[model samples]
Target chain A: MTEGEFKIIFTGPMGAGKTTAITALSDQECVSTDVVNTDLEQCDKALTTAALDYGHIDIPGASGVRLYGTPGQERFRFMWPILASNAAGVIVLLNGQHPDLDEHLSTFVDAFWEGGRMPMVIGVGRLSDDDFFTIDAITEALVERNINPPVLSVDVRRKDDVLLLVEALLCQIEVNELGLAEA
Target chain B: MKQQRLGFVGLGDDTASACLSMLKIMDGRSGISWSLSDPDAADVLMVANESTDETRRWEHTSKPRIVVYHHNEPKPSASHVLQHPFRVMQLLSVLEDVASLLAPTQSQTPLKTDLPPSSIQAGAEAADVGEFWDSLHELLYGDFPAAAHWYVAQSDEGELWLDARSRRFMADPLLLKRMMHHNIRPGVLRACNAPATEGAVACSLFAMSWMITPHLPAGLSSWISADSAFQLLRWPSFGSLAKSRSDLTLCALLTKKALTRDQVLSLSQAAEDDTDRFINACAMSGLMRYDKADLQTLPGVSAEAAGSRFGGLIKGLRSRLGLSA
Candidate 1:
C-alpha cells in the first residue's frame, strides 16, 4: 500500500515462468538470483529457474511494487512462510502441464499456508502446450476447495499480461484494504 | 582408426568389474579408459557416490561421456545405475541410449564456434578456459533430466532395506510361496518382496518406516508400509482392486473377503516387528480372512462349506503375500 511497505511473492513449482513473467512487468531495477535449473528429470525440457529471482515494478499510479520469486522446488518450501511475512499478496503459479492440477493445488495450498489463512490468493495459469484450461475451469477447481480467490490466465513474458494481473489483484486488495493498516 | 573412447573418474574395481561385464556383451567398436585413482583419467566419468563434495567439483572439470553409477544422494549432477543384478540389462540399455547421444562426431567440432553451437567441447590445453567452463555448465546443466535418467539407469541397485526373507520374495516369488506354505506370515513375506523400482520402493519404505516406528497407531499405516509386496504381485496382469490403491487399496480389498480374527492374527504372526501388529489391527477392523465369528463360540470352522471358503481365502492370501511356494 505504502512505498516499499509491501511486496508480491511469486511462488510455484520450477519452470512455471515466475521469473520471466516478473521481469516482463517490472519497470524499475529488478534484483534476481537465477541459477539455470539443472534437474530436468521431473520438469519441462526448455524451462528452468534454479534459485530465487527478484524484480521491481512501478505501478502506473500506485506505489512501486517489488516482486520476489521463490525457488519452485519442494525442498525450498521452508522459505515460503519467511517470504510470506510482510507480504502484499501471493500468486500461486501452475505449470499447466501438470496432470493432477487439483491435487497439486491442494498440496501447494496446504503446504504454503499450514491451514493458516493467507493473503489474497491468485491462481496464475500459465498456458502451455496446445490443450489449455480455461480460467473458469481453474477457478472452479480452486473454489471447490474453498479457495474462491481471483484467478487469471497469464503470459509472464508479456508486460500487458502482467499489468492486467497487477490491476486485478490491486482492486481486490482495495476492497479488502489488505496491507493498509499493517503498513 | 583409433576406437572411440569413454573415460571414468571414480571408476573403482567394482564398477570396473560391472563395466567389464557390459564390455563382454557389448560390440567391440568402443573403448574405455579406466581411472583407478586419477579423477581425470577417463573419457567417461563415473561417480558412484554423489554425497561426497568432490563429485560436484568433478562436474566442473572432466569432459568425458559422464555416467554416474551411484544411489540417490546429493552431489553428482548426472546419471546413476540401478542397484539390482537383474536390472543390469535395463541399465545397459539406458547407457547405450546415452552413449549414442554423446558419441563424438567424426568431425569432432572445435571447442569454440558460432554462438549457440548445438554441440560443445572443452580441452585441457584450451585458452578459452572461462568460456569453456560456462559452455560446459550450459551443456551439462541444460540437459539435467537426460543426465538424471542416465544416473538412474547406471546405478546397480536402489537403497531398499529388506531382510533376507523379504529379499528372496523380490529375487524369486515362488520361493516366497514356499515359505508361506510352511506357515510363514505375510509381514515376513512382504518384508522380502520390496519392489525393484526406486521411486515406488522409496515411497513404500518411507511409509513403512513410519508404520514401524515405535509409537504410531499400528493398523492402516503398517499395512501401507508393506505395500511394496503388492507392487511386485502385479507383474503379469493386475486386477481392478490392486490397481486402485497399491498397498492401502489391497488392504482395503482384503477386508471384503471376511476372514476370522484368529485367521488374520495367524497370518499376522508371520510378520516381523510392527508389520504384524499392523495386520492384526487390520484384522480387528474387519478385513481379510477375519469375519464376524464370535471368539466365545467353539474354535475352528463349524461347517464343511465354511472350511472350504477359509481354505480358499488362505490360498488367495498366500499368493497375495508372495508366499506361494
Candidate 2:
C-alpha cells in the first residue's frame, strides 16, 4: 500500500506570503526560486514563487505530508485548476496590508471552487503584529465568507509557529474526512 | 449628448465597408445616433485615400466636419496624407475611438488621438473593435498585423495581445542596421533567416513584447505593440533568453532590476532582437514610465513593495560581488 500522504496547497493573492508560509513549516527539504514581478501592475517588489515549491514533511511519524505553493498572480490564473486538483487542502495567506480581504477570499473561491467541490481550507492570517490584522479579525473575515477554515495568525518565517497551525489544520482535515466517511 | 452623422470622402471601398459596419453597430445603441452617407450626404466626413489627387481634392473643400482616415501602406505616397488637412482624422483604428468621436457634444475632443483611448481611459470600451477586422483578415487571408501594426489590445483578463503584425515586415527604418535583432517570442529564435508570413512575424513579435514589456526600462512600462517594444529591447546590449513568455521577464526585472543603461542601449540598438526593440518602444510611448504616481495606480502590489523586492535582489547580488549594501 502506498504510504498515506496528505497533499496540501498554498494560495492567495500576489504578495500574500504563500511561499514563506510553506517554507516555514515544511520539514523535508524544500525547493524554491523566489523572484520579483514586473508586469503592468508594476509589482516588481513582490516576491513571486516562480516554479511550484514542494516540501515533504513527516506528519509526526504517521505519514509524510506534502505541501505545494503556486503563484497567485492573475496572469498565472491559468495554472490554478492544476494546483487545485492536486491539493487535498489549502492554506490561504492574506497580506493583511490590504483592506479587501473579503474580496480577495471571494476571488480565490471563484478560482478554486467555482467548478467543483471546494477543498478543506485553513485561513492563515499573515502580518500578525501589523495594526490592520489580528487573529480574531482574520477569523471574523473568514467566518463572514462562510469559510470558518480554522483561521489563525501565522508568521511564515517561523518553523514552530507554522507547525502549530499545520497541526491544527491536519486535525480539522481528519475530522472532516471522518465526517465524510460516515456520511 | 448631441449626436452627429459620419461620412467618407475618398475612402477606399474596403475601409468604407468597415466604417459602414461600425455605423450599423452604433445605430443600435441608445444615446448615439449616426448615419453613413457618401461624401455628398454626410454632415461630418471621414476621408481615406492613397492617391495624391484624391487627398488634395478633400483638402480644398471644407465640410462643416471631416476626419481623414489615411491608409498608410508601404508605397511612398503613404505619408502624403500628412500634408492634407489638420482637421482631418485618421481611421478609427478601434471602435471606441469612433464611438467617442462620433457621439459628439460638450468638450472639444481632438480626433485621431495618437494612442487609442482604451490604454488611457477605461469604460465599456468593450469587445475589442479590432476583432471584426481580425476575423475578416483571417477570412480574406489579408495581413491584418501588417496593415494595422500599431494597434495593441489590453485583454480583459489584464494580459496584452497583439492585433497587427506590421513590425515583422517593416525593418526599423529609423535605427542603425548593425544592431543585434531578433523577434521576442518565448522559446522561438528571433533571428530566423527564413522569411515568415507577416502574420507569423507579427504574432511572434507581439508574443515576445507582451512578455518583455513589463521588465522594460524605467522610462517604458505601459502596453505597447511588440514591434515598437522590440525596438526598445534592442537598446539593451544584454539579451535575455525568456522569449517574453508569461511575463517571466517582468518578474525578474522588477525583482532584480538587473538591466543597465548600457545593456538597455545595446538591446535597444539590437535590430535583430525583438524583445529589446519592444522594451524600447513602450518606454518611448510614455505607456511605460518610472513615475511613482503611475506605479501606485497599478491594480496589484504597491510600488514600494515592488521596489523592495528589487532592493533585496540587488542586496543579494551586491553581497555576492563583495560590494557594499
Candidate 3:
C-alpha cells in the first residue's frame, strides 16, 4: 500500500527563498516565524526567518504533503533535526547567485544525510544573469558524495515550481518504496 | 557536410594523431568536418610546444589559432588554448569555436556526430560484449550494492518486464548502453511506471535519459533542432557540467526565449557544439525543455506583476510586524 502522509523539509543557507516558497505553495496562509533582520553582513533581506515556516497541501488519491522550512541561519540549526523528524524527503533550496553556493550545498548535504540516507531534491533560486552555481555543478557535488538526487532550477515564488519539487519528492518516495519491496 | 581545413604546427606526431582520432569521433555529428591541410590554405591552425618560428609564421596569417599547452605551462594568449591530454568534448569545443571564428555564416548548422559502433550494435563478439556489459553493470550496481532489482523499459521476446539482475539481459547491448549512459536507476523506472506500453516505455526512457546523459542520441536531437523553439526548464545554475563561460552565456540567453540553435549561436561567441553541449547538459540537469511550438509568443508573467506581488507581500509583513514601510 502507498503511504498517505508525507512530511518534507525545506532547507538551505540564508537568502534561499524557503519562506517565500512555503508561502507560495501553502494552501493555508503560511505560518512563518520571521523577524527583522539584524545580520546585514549575512544577508541583505529586510526580514529573516528565525524558527520555521509551516504549510500543507492535499493531493487527491495520494499523500497529503506537509511542508516545513528550516531557518536559514546557522544559529537556529538545533531545530533542523527536530523539524526533519519523520520527514519522507528533503527539498534543499539554494541561492544560485551566491558566491559560496558550492560550499553551502556541501555543508547542508552533510548535515541532512549525516545520520542516515533520505531522498533529496535540490532547487536553485535567483539564478539570473551569469550565476555560477549550475545544476550540473550541484549534481556533481551530490554525486561526489554518492547522492544522486534530482537538481532543478526553481523560482520559489511560483506555486507550480514549488509543487514540482513536492511531486519530485513523492516520486522519489515511490521509487524508494519499490526498491525496498523488490529487495 | 563542408570539411574544415586544419593545419598543425609544432605538434608531435602523437598529439596530432590524437587530435585526428578526436576529430573522427566528432565527425558526422556536427555540420563541419576536419581535414589536414597546408598552413596557408588552412582555416584553423593548432600550435603546440611553443615553436617560436612556427608561431611567428602563423602570427602573420589571418587563420584563427588554437594553442595547445601543458597544464603547468603558462598558456599562450590566444583565442583558444587546449590543455594537454584534453578530453574529446573539450577538443570538439575548441574546434567548433575556431570554425565559428573562421566562417561565421557556415557555423550555424545544427551539429550532429555519428554514434560509435560500440554504442549501438548488440551483436558484437561474445567476449567483447560481455566485458562491456560487466563494466556497465559494475558502474550501476557496484555503487549501490543493496539495489537488488533494476527495471528497464525495453522488450525481450515481446515481454516488457523488469530484470532483477544485469546478467539476465546480456543479449541486449543497447539496453545496457542506455543503462550506463543514462545512469538509469530503480528510482527512474518506478517514477516512470515501468511495464507500460512500448511507446510509453520509450518516452519514459527518453525523459529519464535526458535527465542524466551529457549527450543525447540522434533521435532526440530534433527536440533542440535549429528551427525548433526551446525554453529553459529553469534558470541555469553555474554548477552545470558546462565547460566554458560561453556555455553559461548561452544558458542565460536561453532563459528569456524559446530560441533556435542558430539564434542562440548568433547571440554569443559560443560554437554549435559548445551550445549543443550546454543545452544537453541543461536538459540532463532538468534546466531546459524543448518543443516545436514557439513559446516566446505566449503570455508570460510581467516584471511589473511580479514586483507588485512582492511589494504587497512586503507591505503585509511590515503591517503585521508593526514596522513602517
Candidate 4:
C-alpha cells in the first residue's frame, strides 16, 4: 500500500450485504467469487461468496481506496486476517432481521478487533419498524464488550448509504494517523 | 373501470350519512366508483352497530359485510371492520379490499392509483406500468418461495450474482452501474446464482428492477430486530392492502403499546414470515415508529377472561361465515 492509498475491509455474517455495499461504492468493475450456495440450511439464499470481493475508489490526490470483502461464512475464517492485513479500517455489516443479531455483532466485532483495534464502523440492514435491536441497543452491547465504534443504520443497495460508511471510516483513520504523526 | 355498488344496513342515519359523504370524497381517488343506495343489490354490505339478529339475516344472504363497532363494544363476526369516526384513507382501503375479493382473478387490474394522474402518463403506457408493478408485488409477496430465496441470496451475495427470475439484462457490461441505478443488484445476483444459462442473468436483472424500483422508499434499508418495540403512526385501514387476518390482528395490537414482533406473534395466530413482511411494509410506509423501550411486562390475563374473549372472537368469525357455533 502506498502513502496516499488506504485499504478498507467489509466483514459480516452470510446475509449481511457486505458484497453489495462494496459493489455500490466501487469506482471500477468489482471482482467477485460467488458460487452456488450449498449452505441453504444455514442461509436461505441461492448463492454464497466462495472467495473475497475486491473493488477500488479513487480519493482525490490520495492513492485511492481499495475495498475488500471477506466471505461471510465461518468456513472462510482463515481469510479474515489475510484481508485485514495492511487495512486501515474495517466496516462491519449485520443483518437486522437475523434471529441471532446480537451474537453476529459480537462474533464479527471480536474477529476484526483481534488484530488490535482498527478504525471500524458498524452498519445494520433490513430492519423492520418493530425491530428490538435498535442502534442504541447495539451500541450498548458493544460498550459492554469494551469495543466502542460508530454504529449506523444502512441499506447497502443505496450508494449514498455505503459512501457514508466509507466516509466515517476514512475520518476515523485520518484522526488516528494524525494523532500518531503528532506523537 | 368496473362500477361496484356498496350499501349500509343497520347503521344509524347519522353514521350512514357520514359514511356516504366519505365514500363520495373517495369516489375517484380509489380505482372503484361507488353507489350508496339499494342494499338488496349491494355486492358488499356495511353493517354498523347492527343487532345480532340483523347481522345473522344479512350473513345468510351471501353479501360480504364489514362490521363497524366502537372500541368498548364486543367486535362483530365479519371478514372486515371499520371503526367509528372514519377517515377517507380507511374507507378507500376497504373498498379496494372488497374489489380484490370480488375479482381475485383480475390480478392485473390496478388496485388504486396511488400516484396522481398528472404524474402518471395516460393510456396504454400507464396501464402497462401499473400491470408491471402489480406483477412485481405478486412476485415478491405472493406464494412464490423462489422470490424469497432470491431476496435472501441477494442480501448475502451482494453484487456478485444475477437473479434467474429477471427477464432483461443491462445493455452495459458494467453490472455495478446497473446495480447502482436500482440498488437491488445483490438480490438479483443471488436469484441468478444457479442460472442454467447466461441469458438468465439479464432476464433476472430486468425482473429485479421491475420488482424493486417502484417500491424503494428513500432511506429504508435499515434492519429491524425481531425484539424491538413499535408504535403505529397511522391507523391501518382494512382492505387497503392484501393483509391476512393475522396482519390485521397485529395491526390492532400495535394500537395499544410498543410491542416486539415476537410478542405480537405470540399474542396472535400470525405466521412468523407474514408478520415480518407486514412489519417491514408498515415501517417502509411510515405507518410505524420504532420505540427504544424494552418490552413492557404486563399482568397475566386470568384464564377465564382470556378464554371468553378468545371464544367470543372465534364465535363471531364463525357466525360471519353463516356457521352455527
**TM per model?**
0.32, 0.32, 0.40, 0.37
Task: Name the lDDT value of residue B275 in candidate 2.
Answer: 36
TM-score of chain A of each: 0.76, 0.74, 0.87, 0.89
Candidate 2: regions farther than 4 A off: A1-3, A33-36, A40-47, A58-63, A113-145, A180-183, B1-325
Model 1: which docking level applies?
incorrect
Least well predicted 10-residue stretch by lDDT in candidate 1 chain A: A174-183
Taking the candidates one at a time, how many backbone clashes does each contain?
A: 41, 57, 15, 29
CAPRI-style quality class for the chain A–B interface of candidate 2: incorrect
Candidate 4: tens digits of C-alpha lDDT, residues B1-325 = 4788888878876567667755643444445678876778898888876567666678667777788787678866667888775544456556766776887654443233223222222232222322333333333333442332121122321333322132223222244334434443232121222322222222223223423433444322245555567655433322111223454445445533466665556654567666665665565334567756463453222223242312332333224323322
Q: List, for all models, the DockQ compared with the true complex.
A: 0.01, 0.02, 0.03, 0.01
Name the lDDT of candidate 2.
Answer: 0.41
Best by DockQ: 3
Candidate 1 global TM-score: 0.32
- lDDT tens per residue, model 2, B109-153: 321223333232233233432332222223223332122223232
Model 4 ranges with Cα > 4 A deviation: A60-62, A129-133, A180-183, B1-325
Give the per-residue lDDT of model 3 (tens digit) for A1-183.
124655779999888988888887666898989899998866788988899999876554444567899998888989999988878778999876554566678778777864325767788877532222245446655655655566777788877567666655544443343222110
Against the true structure, candidate 4 reaches a TM-score of: 0.37
- Candidate 4 whole-model C-alpha lDDT, 0 to 1: 0.56
Positional deviation of residue B176's Cα in model 3 after best superposition, in angstroms: 29
Q: Evaluate model 1 with DockQ and give the value.
A: 0.01
